[model samples]
Target: MRPIGIVSILREQTPAPDRSFNFLMAAAGNNTGNLLFTHAVWEHLPGPKERIGFQFDPDKVNATCRAVVFPAANWFGAHVDLADFADRVERLDVPVTMIGLGAQDHDFTGKVDVPEGTLRFVRAVAERSRSISVRGTYTRDILARHGFRDVTVTGCPSLYQPLQPDAERRLLENAKSTLGPTLLHSTRFSARYRAFVDTPSIHLDLYRYAYRTRSDLLFQSELEEISLLVEAAKKPDIDDALIATLLDLYGAASWEELQAYLHNSARVFFDIPAWTQAMTGYGRAYGTRLHATIMALNSGVPALLVHHDSRTREVCEFADLPSLKASRAALDEDAISKSITRADFGKFLKTRGRNQETYRAFLADNGLL
Candidate 1:
């Protein structure tokens, strides 16, 4: 029987000693958060499979594989460059399926300027599949506008990563437990988008809370944080300007204090299992990174998402995850405590089960099951 071909790096192929930041970024598709869903998709698909790169040959793939699967990210946006990927997909002859594809925008206004290449990519996949799995209603709506109605809102494959049958009950129990020192999945400030204007304040407040409580800080794609980790590991000459900028941004008291936090409290993981295992130590997790929060939940740690854009917000709403918008979130000690306490775990469990069934049906329809 022919195996399916997955468009992802299932695990860290690069050895630890030789893994530079560029290699890590490439393995993660430029963001460490991508590992969550991509790994989930890889896990859920049954039978034999081969990991294929985007530069694959159509003739070889059609001859060797039954189908090809894409565990996609926020591909529907003006900023994404998918011209080469679209061309590759267009040439593929085997059945194609995409899971957890999403549209990125500042808000859920349904006004996204998708590039022509991305549109072509969507069409090519749609042509070869029974249905396309999307992250939320926003993504479904975006595809609907392009005249593709066969879309399913599966939230994200990452939500289905945990193997325990009683995972939802455990997650609920964990959420109700007394709060402890939290893990902050931090995001840095960016001026490239309008939604990022509120990022600094949200991140600063989270950083201050983490500092006061002695909680660890987790970084995903931020270059400055990665640089600090690289410096610590390699013993390189420190970038003083980068440290100063981060110190100011995060409201650290001094360079020494910031250094202490970086050395002791900051963490970046290149491996998915290690990252999920680390989340188990934290009583709670909250931040702007969606997959980081999902990782915590997968570890039976309660998590709250502070969503800044439609890409994050739509999934939170669809999955029934505990969330507060960055614009409306009050990050004070009392507010944060209340937000975590007020999350409706019962409702979340109910919605999660329904979404899981939908996801399984999607896979079955696409002949992946």
Candidate 2:
């Protein structure tokens, strides 16, 4: 059977000849939650194994095979440049079906006023596709205003696909009963983007509080520290506090020493199952990394999301994820307890089921599966 083409970042066959360059690219791709989620969706697509693979090259897409599926994420965001991307997607002559697509607002405002480039890309997708699967009501409403009503709210495919109806029930039961002291904290501390924002104080606070409380915090997203450590050695102009915070967080005295510790310890996880499995024994997980928290939730660990941006808040609100705004998330015992205690996984599970059904139906309607 001819494979259903996925419009995603497929692994490059011919990697850069430079080993360090290829290593960084691989890390960047794996560190990105969307890419991981995309791989999961492709892995679980309802079709024969031989009938699905990434077709990012537009010229390769033709009517001889199955329809193209562009899986979900915060694709429509303020920071993204979509003009060339839209043109490339449009070049595909075959049918396109977008699943769990979302728009991101950095300021957390619900209202979305996208630029022409974004509008052009959206219009192109709308024109080519039978229906667009959106992340939540927020995206649905946003796209509706933009004159694209052929949209369905399917939530994130990563949260729903490989669906387990009993997963949430099990997680909730665990939360109420044998919840432990080990906490899996998924952080978003990227030194590559450190200059953009102040590293959301709540994340730092969580690291400190979780460590001091002796709750055994297993931190994810160590690539940023790795990046900083590498950069600090090459250039002396790097921020002193940035270096200090990383050292303090990881308990490393120097960059050279931290690099060795990181390599030896193997702290960063690039694979989804590896990351998800690591969260299993944890009592409760909290993190600003939205997908990491979702992975925890999907894996039946009682989890809470510390939302840092509009994309995070949208998913939390849309899916009823137990969440606190990073701006207001106080690291007090009462506050933490309240956030965890009030998490309604039962409600979220129902929503997840419905969204999964809606998404599958969207694919079926588009002749995808």
Candidate 3:
């Protein structure tokens, strides 16, 4: 099959790097989703070779690529302009672009009222006659709502992509810190459950750049993100191994000191596990990271997603998981705790497997299965 160029619209993640790319790499037993899909599509290509291009930068994409894959532009924070790029890609005529993440990034770099560059992105994509797919069913719905016809809800590329042997083990095994019942908070960690937006009262330019991205004098919005979670990690119910992670990501006197801090913060018996394993450990989790929730459900963790963005709900409901809406004061911790404990992991797994099969069938029907 011919090698396809993958234009990754990846933006800077919160201070801590999000690992969607990591999962994609795993999909092909390679290092990125671009490679995985390229390899997968290679099988159906009426070509003579068996390799794929590995360009991660959208600007530097090779001209020979007949198609490109983008997880979802909306979730990438919508920080860059793509009108020119889209025009260039459109010139390819036969180029196939995949939009995986849900609608465009809501606010530019986490800030509201800021101009959105992705709206142009959507317009460019809409001009196309054919497309690959997106991650969440909501994406498909939204596209349809927006009058887009050549799109489909293809599960997040991360689920179909392959990964390295022991990658999960390495991600978790390398982690050995002390954590209490701490929520793994990021800027958008639980954005859906609670609108953790920068309060308008906070006037630090870095803290609130008038939109999604924020930074500040003492701590960038990113660092505060780390601080809040680290603070929560001190609970007795938290995992002991994740403490060090907090310390490093946030800042601590030491692992021991971090543990002491968490103890003081409101300790919960939090056994932080791997991204996927956390679902298994918690028996249930409320998360904003789409893949984390997906992994949790796949791991049999009865996860109630805090749909920070559309993808979470789109993916969750697509899998038949009863995801809840995001509201700062909406969730009752007591109620959530009870439901999680009572959730039948086995039943959830069966449901997920059925969804998986149906999704595979969809892919196959599209010649991508």
Candidate 4:
């Protein structure tokens, strides 16, 4: 098997000189989730592995690998320069398979119109590749409208990752019993974005709910790490404006108090193994953090997603993972308990297995497997 080039947001470094500061900040939370699917694609394909540089050079990449794999997300958003990315990818003559691509939306149900730049990118991908793997029905439909019929509705790769079934069952039993008081609440409050109008309020509501309920809130995004670094006076590159914005978004009176609060009642994770390790004793996990909920599900813990936008909602709906819309109204413990009890791992895992087969077929049909 010839090496296949994988190009993605692989956040494999701290002081990443290759990426922009904004990209690095976003990657802190997104990289692992993206890699969850990318790695699965790599293993599925016939290849000796070669990670293509984030800096896309067509001739150099083509010379090294048989094909290129792009694990994409929310490609229909306004923030990314899809035109530039398409232009660069167009220069490559190798086969490209874009897995788990999606479009961002303002709400859980509404769809954002795809821009010309995004359409161009999709066209370029369609021209070079066999089929594009999408996140859900919404993304598939969006591409269909733009004349891309080869799109496959493969749910995000996070749902199909490896899990410890026996270990998870024991944890679930503990949750069902009275021995576990610990609840995991995942929230994302720090990011500069324009698509979701209710994201900040939704996060604030989740934070308040976690605080009132005494749940151990978890932070997965880079902003959490950035805040920790700034507090420790370790991130010398961060500007005062960025620090002020971060502090304001953190919703704390002081940096020390924020640190104290997190240290006492919250936990931060940088990788999957440590995250699953931490999930062992927790009774339930609930909040807007999509992957965090998925991680819990994969770990055998009952979890619920507080879906604030289209991406989370569609993925949950497709994968049969338990989820609810983001609301400012307070959610009582009784309601939370009901949702947790209703989470059926047996059903969800069955659906996940089926979706994985479909995803594998998609890769095979495209000549990757």
Clashing pairs in 2: 3-51
For residues 4-26, what per-residue lDDT tens digits would candidate 3 score against the true structure? 44444221122123434233222
Q: Tell me the lDDT of model 1 at 165.
A: 46
CA RMSD for every model?
Answer: 2.9, 4.7, 11.7, 4.0
Q: What's the CA error at residue 179 for candidate 2, in Å?
A: 4.0
TM-score of 3: 0.51
- By TM-score, how accurate is candidate 4? 0.83
lDDT of each: 0.79, 0.65, 0.39, 0.67
| TM-score of each candidate structure, all chains considered together | 0.90, 0.80, 0.51, 0.83
Summarize candidate 4's per-residue lDDT along 197-306 as a digit string, tens digits. Answer: 23457676666566555567776554544455322323335455545544565555665665566667776554456667878777777777777888777777778787
Using TM-score as the measure, the top candidate is 1
Please identify which of the two predictions, 1 or 2, would achieve the higher lDDT against the true structure: 1
| Clashes per candidate, residues 3 or more apart or on different chains | 0, 1, 50, 0
Runs in model 4 deviating more than 4 A are 11-35, 38-46, 108-111, 167-175, 181-200, 222-226, 229-255, 328-330
* Higher-lDDT candidate of 1 and 4: 1
Model 2 regions more than 4 Å off: 10-30, 48-55, 111-113, 163-166, 184-189, 192-200, 210-222, 226-242, 245-266, 332-338
Poorly placed runs, candidate 1 (over 4 Å): 13-15, 163-166, 189-200, 230-238
